[model samples]
Target chain A: MKKLSFAALAGLLATPSAAFAQEAGGIDQAVNEVFAAVTGPFVNLIFAPLPGTSFPWIVLWLVVAASIFTLYFGFIQFRAFKHAIQLVKGDYSDPKDAGEVSHFQALATALSGTVGLGNIAGVAVAVGIGGPGATFWMILAGLLGMASKFTECTLGVKYRNEYPDGTVSGGPMYYISKGFIERKVPGGKIMAILFSIFCILGALGGGNMFQANQAHAQISGILGDYPGWITGVIFAGVVFAVIVGGIKSIARVTEKVVPFMGVLYVVAALVIIAANYQQIGWAFGQIFEGAFTGLGIAGGFVGALIQGFKRAAFSNEAGVGSAAIAHSAVRTKEPITEGFVSLLEPFIDTVVICTMTALVITISGQLMVDPATGNYLMDGNMIQTVGGTSGVALTSAAFASAFSWFPYVLAIAVVLFAFSTMISWSYYGLKAWTYLFGESKRAELTFKVVFCVFVVIGAAASLGPVIDFSDAAIFAMAVVNIAALYVLMPIVKKELNSYLSRLKSGEIKRFKG
Target chain B: MTTSIVVGLDGDGSGMRALDFAKKLAKGMGTCELILVYVIEWSPYSFQTAEENAVRHKRREEEIEAALERVVTPSVAALKKEGFSARGIVRHGDVADLLNTVAVEEGADQIVVARSSEGGFVKRVFGTATANLVMHATVPVTVVG
Candidate 1:
């Protein structure tokens, strides 16, 4: 049976390129075509426009939910923002009784997970297609999305399964099931199962595939056009080693390195912005004007809003329930504390870091603006730029315009970002996988192997379909997760109220300033 | 005047040398109260994965309980048996900060610690907790080598 399966695998790998050699780009092209076809319906269904409007319903779905959460919680994201900072500062932490993870560490881990290609490539896509107008909407979405993160993450910790050992299992899947049971709502199990399935798909698509695809794109942009499959193979090998081979040292190295890269990327962007200091006011004018009138861009203001919300959702993963999994690891007895801490994730991921990218892109003048129309010139659905590139390429071009050596640094940062994001998402997907298949070693190994395989496929495949599918899968998680949150929000409110009252009453002590 | 002295422990047996030194100082001063402090070196800025984060609180509880059982409680009892007033404190944070905080909280007039044998290249460059405490502590500090 093993030999037969091995032969089948060998045939599967060899036949694609051989059979489709005449097709442009061989196996990569073939795989992309097949994947696009398979994933098209789901993507369309998820992104399908509202009647007589170009705006996708899923973006509206997420935006509306975030707004509702903001209202429902009375803007806890703002009210508790200072306290959240304090928690992360370890001000409220018991020094003698520290948790396995400090609030700061949890926040940092979740930030690292969310702040990657989505900020780099995804923001470039948003600004490229939607113009600078998207940056305005992106910041708004990020602000509102904080409430969504707060709600989902609170539920995550509240409903997490603490085993006999110190380890835990939590996320949308757990909360969908356990929360419903607590609320006496039926179909919790079914919804949880569905959420898990979507989560796994999302992890494979956005978390692994999107990251690998962009990393390869950035590398190939620099190293010259080679088959993405080669890049895929190397990334998959390294990812497999870290996740499967128990090479925690690699994970540790990445954890340390990615943050440094993040700092460097920000610094480089700041340098560009600082160099173009006089254009700062003009950039703001363009953003505000473009946001309202769309500056004659396609879909105008709506187009800008859609792109902003979509990229923000994709970048921050706020309402998508992925941050819930990461935030659940925080060592706080009061689940609301983690919730408060989590609200900062979107603020940092989208509002701060993403805005930095957008500002640099805006200030760089890589995006061509129409002098007569006071609009951005569009070519084939993307802003007509110097090289007509999009995603990380556009970002690279923007940076390279300022400093020729920056792209080399960006390439390294992109790879590190991609690697760290993939590592984080693998864990998220694994939790969801174990939730569905049970926590057996075989079930886990199966999921990890499949995850690694998708890394190669993600790298090899073209960007459009991979991005479409990635967005669809991640938004699908939001659909299920937001529905669950709508029901479970009262619970979060109760936890929040209780925590606040205790703080007021001095029941919750501040251990440090 | 019932002088109080804070003695820092490294959680290992190495702290006994500092305790012995503080005891002699207390004997010379007369009517000195000893506060045994065991600090678990920690910094909030350190990175950890989700799995590591999950087990951290549990591990912390175990470390505190073990320190109390295997070190602090016994030493406190032994000091009391020797006709001296002694209490132990165990905490998780930056060693120097927490020790200084504990000393201030306990109204200690002196702080005493053994020279850390764990000194390496990094420690030498960054300075050890003993060095930090000696440099920054408001009270007198004694480093027993």
Candidate 2:
């Protein structure tokens, strides 16, 4: 779920650029066309809809895996929700513990990685295309996604490689390989390699490109028409400064600033929702009505479901396994604790934050609803907008209608979100790169340079094929990761049960009352 | 009866003054035990990047070791050499809270801290450890300025 905001932005950006590509002439344009042509077959295969259905099979694959995990874990997301909060609150964290950071810090860092543009622009994309009904499916997907996160993160900690120097590394790559070998499953090594390759690509595609692309979009949207490559070059330079220059000051500033931005965005959305208190019920009615009946919208309820689930999955990334890498660094004796901590991620990212964006968009009176049929007026296939905008711009318009200065604030937030996501993903990609090659200074530098270069390419190019390939690369990770989870779930169940029994017997101590 | 007193240290002149004041009070009381403690200010809620978080545990351990060697150990040896019952502990957390916790856990008779002279906007807003300990500690708090 590499900020579905960028993926959706790319999707929307692709439409206008596709219409104008012939009129535009440049090396970058030519490169984008060729890249799209070469990767189109692969992207289509990964995202291809099921037979006789408009839904993408990859979406179905993720939804089904999450559903199965929810059932298999006895809906542990719900059952252990309170326990998860307690863990995050430091109730179970001993000050004398051996881990690097507290559960709260780990949760915060992981939250930073997941809760970005996905909640902002991605929600806009879902509600725009899928209608208000997409909000409902998005909430359901988030609920089910908690279980998928639980399973993968537990295995991540269990199979992590703890170094002698007290550093550790783990993710789908480690667990898939080691868990498979332990269970006597063949092709574990090959599967791990495959997952690593996909992860590196994902880190480049969704993590780097999509972020750079959308950051440029949001900036240009505010600053008037300008070449995207210029924005791309500036962004790439800053990113290179952070990742390559090893500038601790930049990380520290962003570490403080990004969370503030997240809060600012949420507060802005809440204020908008509160101002339109009367339309609250009407908007919800549209969400519920559009969810089941589709309200004369295209593809009916199915369209809403696909858009909702896709956006939710892409936003929170429960089954995606990239989060497992981040969660694995948490210090805990029981791996199940990290798993429990992880379930809160989708809830915070999708259920709470994304819903705020959906409500703001729905209540802002941007999407024209017909007074007679009570259906949304459609422009071509999209919900017709009063501002005649789409993607992140539509969201900005909705918020700006309320605050009048939200676009400026949102632009800053989007850039910060993109930079933070890029930095986090760079670490994730570097881990995969080192796993494939050996861990060395040269290897790390090589990945960083290439990653920054892609950031430029991502911003410079039109988003058509870049978005497609990014979506495919990220989903490809889930394809390998979920398959590994299906096999290794019993181990998690055993861990969960043992931990519960110990808690019941008073063996698992709580540091705080 | 031997009384126990917890003295908070900041590894500076103020800390040594606090130690001196505690020693004088302990000597006056006869056969007192001095528990010297130094806390490296930290909060679990502070935001950190993945790379920062990954190294935090090691950094914390290093911090504790450095505090023990550079501050607590020397203070303990000096006190003990002067015929005082002194032991040192180094930890990572908010100074006031940790001092109170240590005092409560040790069943100390009183807490002693040096009033920090570095007063500024941040310190004034957040409040100094001496002010907080004086207000919140269950045991008696003596601020030696």
Candidate 3:
């Protein structure tokens, strides 16, 4: 599985820049073409249905699915909130434990992985295309997503293994196979192998290439004719230095970078909001108004609940097994302790950051428009199509509108966000790779070498539909991943109950400082 | 050539635990000075304008020092009793940066800090500070659990 992800990432990055050139007039014009081709079809699909039809089936189904997970767990995410606080508090500190890193570092590392261009660029796309209404459902989806994260991270911890040397390894592949293994169920190992394949593909397509490509686009556009291929090569090298060091170093770096980037991005959004403070009332009105009323036609609403749910799922990654791959490495013995802290991820990524971006774009009121195509823009007056879940450029334009330096600041932010994400996901893919191949030092180094090559490839390539198909392999991971979570939800329940009982019994008290 | 391997220590008064660990290494080697680091967490008390309140607020450090005397000073006295040369010194502000600077200044062989408890004000201090030392420090760190 890990090998395939690396292969796909390398393939995406290897595509010739001549393919990207298109003899195009400017970098924006070329990159924008890719954006239109990807997002256009989705916008048409969402708006195509006849008027007065009830919300799309996806909307109903997602809401129901999210609600079931939320209620069945009795909002375990909320109850675990205090435990999450204490998890960092050292109520359960075990430095002698088997893991490669500590609980807090693992959480920060996972955040650095998931909270990327999605929060900055993707949120703007959601509001730009889906309209303000999408924000409503985005929050709703995020609310339920907390439940999804809780379920997956718990499974990740339960199924984790410690090598004789104290290195820790666990994720969906292990949980799916091992959970059923204990039950003496057949096909569990086969299922585990399939999930590993999906994970490796996801990490390469989404975690590495997709990130590198976006980072390339942002930097190259800002710099202009600065030899983009060289820029890409440098990015891969920087990523390599961190990747070769393994999880402890990656964790060490992200624990500092994630909070710095997240807070910085939020502060930028606040500046935009303050610049257009008077228009805030109308922005809120448009959001609630567009969410229900459809902006596609005179009457059609833009995002509806379905678009909101889909985009939110893409943003926070609650159900996906990726974050679980990270939380599993934490040092504590109580799986639930990490699980509690893990829940905070979705809130920060989606509910907080997404909301900030949505408010910023909505307030600016310029309306997203595709200049040449007129596809994403409405009557050429507003956006005809929102960039397919990548809105960094549009958000950049909005920030630049308010402050002269914002575009450059945002460009740097995007690159740093992308860099942190690529390194962390490399760890995730390596674990899955180890599951398929034996865990020899040689095998690990091979994966890292191949992974580094892909970083360069993703940056230089055109990032066409071929890469998009591979990207689907990443999202497709959730289908197999959530299934594994289901069979293993019982173990998750036992762990949570056990941890809670300990907390209440005072067995897990604050270290007598 | 003698390598000046300084045994470095730093924390709040609670850092006595680190001092104990530092003492062991200094005694074992018999060739280094023991530097006890005290990072006085800045508070409103530090700014108390009245002499009494100022003293009371300043007392937090003194109180911490008194506690340190119980934990760290005795080690210094015991080392002197054993006829080995050692000294305990203090510095303040941003525990991680302070530790790093002292490590370089002392040309320390190793740094010893207590494994932070998972709760309270100490969490932020030790968690980030230790992480900083890991990334930026010149010497090896032995975090006593």
User: Which one is best on TM-score?
Assistant: 2
**What would the per-residue lDDT of candidate 1 be over residues A23-87, giving only the tens digit for each residue?**
42554444456667777888999989999988888888888999999999999889999999999
Off by over 4 Å in 2: A1-25, A227-230
Tell me the deviation in Å of residue A338 in model 2: 1.0
- In order of DockQ, best first, we have 2, 1, 3
Model 3 lDDT per residue over B40-68, tens place: 33321121111112123234456557646
Model 3 alpha-carbon miss at residue A469, Å: 1.9
Model 2 per-residue lDDT tens digits across residues A356-444: 89999999999888999889898777888898888888889999999998889989998898988988888889888988997778998
Off by over 4 Å in 3: A1-65, A89-100, A245-255, A295-302, A368-377, A380-390, B1-145
Every prediction's TM-score for the first chain? 0.93, 0.93, 0.82
- Tens-digit per-residue lDDT, A1-513, candidate 3: 334433544444545666645532344344445554654564444324445653443334334555766787789867777767666544566422211244555666677777888888877766665666778878878878888888888778777876654456878888888888876667788887887776776677688878888888888787775545676789877777666653345444544665776788798889889878898887777667667775452224544465577677888878778888887766566777777888888887888888888887777655653447422355422354333223677787666667778788788788888887787777778888889997878887888887877776667665554356445556556666766666777777787777778878988765523
lDDT of 1: 0.85
Model 2 per-residue lDDT at A237: 88
Per-candidate clashes, comma-separated: 4, 0, 22
Shift of residue A484 alpha carbon in model 3, Å: 1.5
Which of 1 and 3 is the better model by lDDT? 1
DockQ in order? 0.49, 0.53, 0.04
Error of 3 at A269 (Å): 1.6
